[model samples]
Target: MTNYHDPIKHLNFLRQTLSLDKKPIGFFVSAGCPLSVEMPKGEWPLIPDVAGLTQYATQELGSKDEEPYNDYDRLLKEVVKSEKDPKNIEDILSFIRSLKVVAVGNDVRGFNIDALSEIEKNICEKIVEKLDVDLPSENSPYHKLAHWISIDRSVPVEIFTTNYDLLMEQAFEDISIPYFDGFIGSRQSFFDLRAVEDDLMPDHWTRLWKIHGSINWFQKENKDVFRTTRTDEINSSHLIYPSHLKYDQSRKMPYLALIDKLSKFIRKPNSLMIMTGYSFNDEHLNDTILNALKSNPNTMVIAMLFGDLTYKDDNGDVIENYPNAVKLARNRSNLAIWGKDEAIIGTVRGHWHTMDDDFDDSINLANSITFVQKEGEDGEETDEKIYSLNLGDFSKLGEFLQALIGYNQTNFDEN
Candidate 1:
């Protein structure tokens, strides 16, 4: 019946991975990163998440009356009515792309390829417009991450992100950090598959792989994918939204290659992957990670969720947070799910339990995890058996990293 997970023990394991300079450390940052950024004076996120972007795209597309808009409107209505699961603009785009690779082709909604192309372009441009905003300041979380990467290490740091925004790149450049994103040549940076495959770059140079296509990426008439600093110059039709639909060409693009890189990175011995701001929403990626875990027993994946592992429902039922992820972690010894108030490590799913004497190294360790009160059936407050973990949010995670580097530790106890 004793089912509490020790945060101190789990974090010590994490510290070992981070402390060892020779170990290969990687980060999988997803949509929550941008959303976690604080906007000045209660402004919205620098860029909207998928749901927010979907809402924005819906409003923008619905406002227009042109041929493309009409086609998009019809397609949206039909797609939503029939499928009922196209959650965001990316999912919608993935659906459209799936249609392309199918036998039906552009004949699904009585629309041709040209109309589909137009619809994709409209959504992509809107997304780019929304994501083009610059970082808030040098003290941002991303900049902190950049600082973390800048630390002395024998093995190169690999950062894999599914976002199309340039925030990560901006963070690296802001600190004069040398990094490569699988692009080579001058102004029009063409993707060098060999460079990505070989990874001959120095250890100091970070490898930034954007698994999802970026705003700077575009396709030429020759079907060559190239990147540029100018987002406005690129066409959205070329962006890769890899879904279940498989094709020979897509397997060769940066999507497959970057995904393969993830698999390869995890397969390496002693490799540790820290996932932040990522839910198990991406089933394809979920499969990739789980399969990798099965293949490599020596590696570890620590997923940091933005919420607690369990919540009280209206029926007073304890609902697990991101159940699929938790389930996967329970089955895989190498995979750890780190939530706000609890964690699942080595097939043990439970809340954090720690004592005051657990703080040996830094006082900030006490700041990250704490104990909250509980109530009894008589409506009186009772003692709780566990602690509340708060390292899921990117802001707190960044402060933890800063505290590790001796930059700042005061924020760990603050907001």
Candidate 2:
């Protein structure tokens, strides 16, 4: 069968053809990306306290507590049932959005591990495992790309991620791959400054821009000063939760300055962008991305569309076929799609099957589908067959990155 996971071969091919050095290439990751490695089975892992707030809100709303019921839950139930008025639904969503992190924390804390049904407990355990484990070095596509870029090209790479998880950061660290995300600083004044001085920054490392903030990031005092990841107890006040208004709130000076810096990076001429596991749901993020694309016509975007590549609207009609795939296809003049048919196999497959029906489980299932096709002698057609680990699987991540590097090197040679 054809191996779809062969990223190196593909990279070599692209390098032989494309003019890469004329442009800078970047990779953007969203939280939904399945960049994580398999976690070992374990007991209740410590859920971040930020997730506990969700449970607190749920219990407070459900019980006859002294805390005033904002009718948030009732409105949510109504909204789900489609019985609530549009305005009421909007208001309820607004409230829920505001309380998301708190609500997530509370939800985790509320789960009675001992009392849970086997399947339910398994689901919770899986999420905990996913949260705790670092991204697998061998399987992570991002790292693979980083390795290729580091070895093949002289051009600097910029990594922009919206995930709060440390998977990407851990990958870079594990490989001794230097990176900057505006969080690192000197020991003497580290506690005071928000970012490392431009002069002290290394030339070879990737510059990471955590657009949606990070789990390890926190604010200090009332000032706009920030802190990097630490081994000590997490300060609950520092975590930035994902919400609809997050981008708006970030528009305040400090965040605005960061965004300005990030924007300039993207606006640079001949920039190629590759996006993975991003759902394109955040309007503010979408606007920024669209603006960047519009600003540079030579820019190219390669997006991976995961899952069934289909969707249904309110009326239960398939108004948009291949919703995720199609939306991505329409967005850019120069774009390539991947991950429509790549599946996780071996031990990872077994692990996913053991998990309960939850977000993590669903993600695992989605990651299990692989790309397949058939070929025949000469130009003749034959029965189509599914190909595994060809150019689309996680294993090919490094190869893909290498291909970009090769392409860039070719351009450099030509010039």
Candidate 3:
């Protein structure tokens, strides 16, 4: 199940995409990878939001400390038992959100709607608190990334991210890099769907689309959306918290429009998408990528996995080193995979291709998929490099961005 690919091959693919004829290039940054920054102590929770609720339910709920949390615990246990892949905090919260309306009719001995609501609220609060990381002050990596985007006049760019944090926004603001987020107004910004729908974006201005909801974004009683700097308004926070209902949430206003833009972007001719920090675990997101590939022959997707990709086997056995991505990349000439140690490039739909024996040829095969011609053996190509981080370290985002900056700098210097 190993999906590891050579970093060199992956970078070569990236260089080609940057050089594509595509007018405006786009990139995706998943929460899996973020600018490396230390989260402030005591400001965030140490355990999963569900875990905290479990403890509260067991302890604060009197003699039957577990009674209050029994329903949630049961749901979590069932999810663990039923899911082939290991579940995360988001998975647990999402399961709870799904039960909001569907859990009607069937009741055990009794059903306490109030108790369930309280638990849900607590979970959401815990997550918001946990994610309220202290923004990086001096020498922020996101600042550098923004600066790169601002200076790279060679191609127009669009940035899409699944992260709910304001780090990127802060960086862009700090550096005065002009960009559009589909929200307008100097006082109370609202979702300008018309601008996005009409494709009024300028090629020089970078467009940032947060596919998922953000922490600062809130809704008023009248349903007007506004951005804020306050983190204490739990009730006002309108974010699409980690929940199974995310797909449904995405169907609504801003998300729907934003997602549609993503779909359209990938289906355009001469398009290339560079995805990082995303694990492709979300079925909806995976579907979007797969559909984009199927719809456009000239479009290509290059995904970089930050860790060892793993998945469950047919028999539900946990398979290590095997990435779930292989299922999509397999036999797909438009999709290429790069991980810590291995590389899989699109080729004739037959045997699995490995670069272990022939690294140079593998690079050539990857380049060929994007119509990138390699110079002679002695010809110098732009310097590209891959960066890695320790397992489970989200702070490595900073390091990854720094590596990206270095990689781009090398290319700029050489070119």
The whole-model lDDT of each prediction reads 0.79, 0.47, 0.58
In model 3, state the lDDT of residue 244. Answer: 28
lDDT of 1 at 381: 78
> How well does candidate 2 match the true structure in TM-score terms?
0.59
Poorly placed runs, candidate 3 (over 4 Å): 1-10, 19-22, 35-87, 103-116, 137-140, 152-155, 230-237, 241-251, 308-322, 347-415
Q: Write the per-residue lDDT of candidate 3 for residues 1-415, one digit (tens) a residue.
A: 4333344444464554454333456778777544344335753332223335345433432245646656555555555765722236566556555554555555422334454456565555555665556454646546655765765655567788877777678778887887888888765677888998886877767888888767667665565666666445434435555432533332357777777888988898777776766766677777877888898978777666655445568999867453557778875778766544334567321212334333453233212221123355677643333233121233333344444444454433322
- Candidate 1: tens digits of C-alpha lDDT, residues 314-379: 999999779889878879999998887778888887767866534665644526666666778997
TM-score of each: 0.91, 0.59, 0.69
**lDDT (C-alpha) at residue 50 in model 2:** 27
Q: Write the per-residue lDDT of candidate 2 for residues 263-376, one digit (tens) a residue.
A: 665677666666666656555666666677678766556555444334578888755433444554555555445444332211011101111222232222223323333557
Query: Which sections of candidate 1 miss by over 4 Å?
Result: 63-69, 102-106, 231-244, 247-252, 357-363, 377-386, 407-415
For model 1, state the Cα shift of residue 146 in Å: 0.8
Clashes of 3: 19
Q: Model 1: what TM-score?
A: 0.91
